[model samples]
Target: MKGIVLENKILNDKYGIICIKSDEFAQNAAPGQFLMIRPQPYDYIYDPLLRRPLGICDINEKKGTFSLLYMIVGKGTKLLSKIKKKTELSFSEPLGTGFNLTTDKKVAIIGGGVGIAPMTFLSKILHENNEVDVFYGGAEEKDILLTHIFEEYSNNLIIATEDGSIGHKGFITEVFENSLKFNNYDKIFACGPKPMLKAVYDIIDIEKIEFEVSLEERMACGIGACLGCIISTIGTDPNSNSQKRCCVEGPVFNGKEIIWETVCKE
Candidate 1:
């Protein structure tokens, strides 16, 4: 359906936040789910014809609005940044599987860079009924987008920046690992670059903790039609693996189910 752009705030040279007024999207959006939006300001100017997949960053059900945090990665997203307020953009229904929400347990939420977008809503929902700890990391201070918002929804907000511009001086994973040693978290949810997810996968004790990771991929068709967003996952037989569409089967999956080597290689 078509959604009107309520606001498009550019965070920096690299990142921006766009809010859209879509009652259908806001009411239905779940953490980790994404929507595909065409970037052009007008439907006819379709130079970048394909719809860009953006994670559902925040939702205001009563206000009938949803936000997307995106990076200026290519022509599509660059155009997305220039979209004006009140402009109507074409958006797909909220797509992909969202994180499974569980309550009454200690939970760890990890995010890095723009990957932090989807975690906000998840943290908000989880914090209401669970002890939530959020670990956010970025390459620099500019990479940290919405800490104030995260703080409102988490019991503890831990931050790290590689250039020592923010909270911790090292990788966010390092802080996460340290926290894991002290906290017996019952569940964990993460979304970041693949290497960060792999690093997280390596540190967590999967047998003792349930962990899920939201993956990032380039998609041609946000629905399952195109086979462009396929990823490898473990099959019933250890020697083989099965393929899954990132746009449909998941953007969220158990960390254990992913074949890390394949993800790292891609």
Candidate 2:
């Protein structure tokens, strides 16, 4: 799908949010789904031939707009930040399986840093039927992305910062553990840095809370043809469901499907 950048505004100088007016992509976008975006104009040759895959942060159906919130971690994102309004870019969109939004049970979404992108989209939809809680953690105060958005959609909004500059003065895992004392959650959805995701998985597993995690992997081909973004699954036997594709089959997977030993906990 093709889109024209309507706004590209920097937030906290560390990252930026690019809102685009796209009739095709936005109309078909779903919560927690992503798009493979090439920030360069259609005529330009982007240094990296592969488009960067970004999660859909906001979907405004009424306005026919969608936005991507990205952190400037590498060259791909750096280029994305330079893109200006009215820039026409191409995308392969609405890819991968989004979160399953059902159930009247209690649900919690714990995310860190840029991982908060998809959680906001999920929170907005899940809160409509379930009791939802959103726990967002960042490096500092300014890193706490969008609190007002979460507040409007979730039943409880909690935040954590490494620098003690925000709601809770520790990792989001700490906040999650404390939250368990007061709330009995039936399910959890987490997306974040590997360590935080692992920690959340461990705790929720012990509590026997049904949960799913969204994995982040580097993909050269967003269509899963390159097999570049493979994640380990429990069934390790050959021809088994041992290797999962982050681009096609997921981004979201059952908690038990992940092979914890294969992931670096620390």
Candidate 3:
């Protein structure tokens, strides 16, 4: 499908938000699904042949717009950063399975840096019927972008910075740990650096809390065909004792089923 870039600007020194006009895509998009974006502006097509995968940050059905939040990393994203208003781009959207929004109404969704992007839509839909708490962290003040959006959708939006420049002066993980001491979350979902997701899983694994985590990987083909984004899984599947493509079968997966150390090992 095709969409027009309505807004594209920096969130901070590290991140940018790109909003697009696409009614059909926005109406059908599910939380955690991504769009393979290929910028085709001013005869610059095919320079970066592979489209980058970005999570759908938000959707406004009435306005005919859907937004993608991205970090300005690498050559592909740098080109994406240059997109101006009204420029049309190619997209392969609503791809892969999104977060499991069907259960555990009282949910804790934790995100860090660019990882916070995907949590927006998930929080929005879940907020309508569930108690949603969002915890976010960054290296410094600038990295802690988009607090207001999360605040709008969450019952409680907790902020943390490692530099102590903002809310809690520690890892978002520390806040998560302390929160679990008293407040019992029915379910937990996390996206960010793998280490953060692993921490969330470790703390609650013993208690048997349900959790789903969205992953990141490099994909040649966003669908399963290319197999460029395979990662090991502990769960029983064809990839059980083997590996699963992060582009399919997951971008979201059972937290308890992932062998954190082995799968995350470099």
TM-score of each candidate structure, all chains considered together: 0.98, 0.94, 0.94
- Give me the displacement of residue 71 in model 3, in angstroms: 0.5
Q: Per-residue alpha-carbon lDDT of model 1 for 14-81, expressed as tens digits? A: 99999999898898889999999999767777588898999999999999999999999899999999
Q: Of the pair 1 and 2, which is ahead by lDDT?
A: 1
The order of the candidates by lDDT, greatest first, is: 1, 2, 3
- Deviating ranges (above 4 Å) for candidate 2: 44-46, 236-241
- Which segments of candidate 3 are over 4 A away from where they belong? 40-44, 237-240
Using TM-score as the measure, which candidate wins?
1
What digit string (tens of lDDT, one per residue) describes model 3 on residues 1-266?
A: 88889889877767889999999998888899888888556446567888889998999989989999888888888888888999988888688889988544788999987888899888988888899999998777877877788888889999999998999998999999999987888889899998888888888854567899999888988999998887777755654476778888889988877779976784
lDDT of 1 at 249: 89
Highest lDDT, which number? 1
- Give the runs in model 1 whose Cα sits over 4 Å from its true position: none
lDDT of predicted model 1: 0.93
Q: Clashing pairs in model 1?
A: none
TM-score of 2: 0.94
Check candidate 2 and list the clashing pairs. Answer: none
